[model samples]
Target: MNTRILKSCLLGAMLVLGGCASGLTGETYSRDEARAPQTVRMGTVESVRLVQIEGTKTNIGTGAGAVVGGVAGSSIGGGRGSIITGVLGAVAGGMAGAAAEEGITRNQGIEITVREDGGQTRAYVQEVDPNMSFAPGERVRVLTVNGTSRVSK
Candidate 1:
């Protein structure tokens, strides 16, 4: 009974955390970006560097962790001891959960520096796409929509 509830809560938390992540690849676009016009510029890749994209920090992760921790901790003891352990568990769980959520959603990205045809140089960072690779001297397209830009072959 208690185990079932715990499992359900954990599953729910996982689902919520998973739903929070969205695609950050060059080929991915948000719903609002669909049917929108983008400005395109031709550029030559000046450099490419690997980077890490940070994950989100949200109350959902912390709250869910706290709940799970509290439940698990409260089950450990009785009376006041249970309450104390529950509180401590909630605190520890919250921190662990937040970190877990962030780590799970973090992405590998690339910082692509490009020299535009207009003689302007800029760097754009996007989640690394397994299907596309960029080299320093390769020609690419810089597409900008609503001030957000991505580099693609």
Candidate 2:
């Protein structure tokens, strides 16, 4: 009876965990509002100024969490505890890897000032592809990137 109950509980827990990690969160944004051009090749950096340095630091919390959880779990019953702990470790490791990758990347933005020929003046790089070629003294058209923003010229 106890074994049966344990099995059922484990199965239920597995199902619940699976559902949570399946990206079931209902969140959607319209393409018009979230779509941006994929790339920009000819735009020049208008106003070359370092806005701010953004840094992503890799955190070993996930892996560390997994290792600790595994060790603790392994010390439990003998077989059952070990199995449960291993699964928990795996999940922790996955989370840690994802966080590390996210933290390792960095992005910096610059305000671009564009000047077209014949005195046509317009600025569109700020928040968009401010880094796109504007020459502070040149001209360009920028495009968006998957919703972020980028140069189009």
Candidate 3:
């Protein structure tokens, strides 16, 4: 049997196994649970907009993919052919890994427009959590403590 299929399998396996984790807790700060003065603004939701939130990008995916692809590609041929295949495989694997990582690490956010009780309007783009949601005219509290803000019902 030719090594093409084997190489493909190896590359696929590497991509699946060698990936990085991006921790997005949606909280601006951590470790300090100490009580801080929070500016609570009671408001009603005027609008809710769906948005895309960028998490992060580390070289782990691309780097791991390239290494595995190069090794897999090298096994299929010899001398110059092997080298060329290795380079090609590395490029493909790296690209795939990066795309996969980006897809996996993506976060969902919502742009919430609220009209305060004092006749002022504010918009907050916050990470979407399954436990939290808002609708038009729903009474909610806007909490901002130490520059970090969140809307809670």
Q: Which is the leading candidate under TM-score?
A: 1
Q: Residues 1-153, candidate 3, lDDT per residue (tens digit)?
A: 346665675566455544443323234444453377778889999999999877446676677667667777777689999999999989987887667667766778888899999999999887777767789999989887767677888
Superposition error at 44 for model 3 (Å)? 1.4
Per-residue error at 118 for model 3, in Å? Answer: 4.1
C-alpha lDDT of all candidate models, in order: 0.92, 0.43, 0.74
Over the stretch 1-153, how does candidate 1's per-residue lDDT look in tens digits? Answer: 768877887898899999999999999999888889999999999999999999999998899999888888888889999999989989988998899799879999999999999999999999999999999999999999888899988
Q: Tens-digit lDDT track for model 2 on 53-150?
A: 33333334344434444444455566776688767755765475445434433334455544434454334423224233334544455444554444
List runs of model 1 lying over 4 Å from the truth. none
Which lDDT value does model 2 have at 133?
A: 32
Q: Identify the runs in model 3 with alpha carbons over 4 angstroms from their true place.
A: 1-29, 32-37
Ranking by lDDT: 1, 3, 2
List runs of model 2 lying over 4 Å from the truth.
Answer: 1-77, 118-153
Worst 10 residues of 3 by lDDT: 21-30
- The order of the candidates by TM-score, greatest first, is 1, 3, 2
Global lDDT of model 3: 0.74
Candidates 1 and 3, the one with greater TM-score: 1
lDDT of 1 at 41: 100
- Highest lDDT among the candidates is held by which one? 1
**TM-score versus the correct structure, for each prediction:** 0.97, 0.33, 0.71
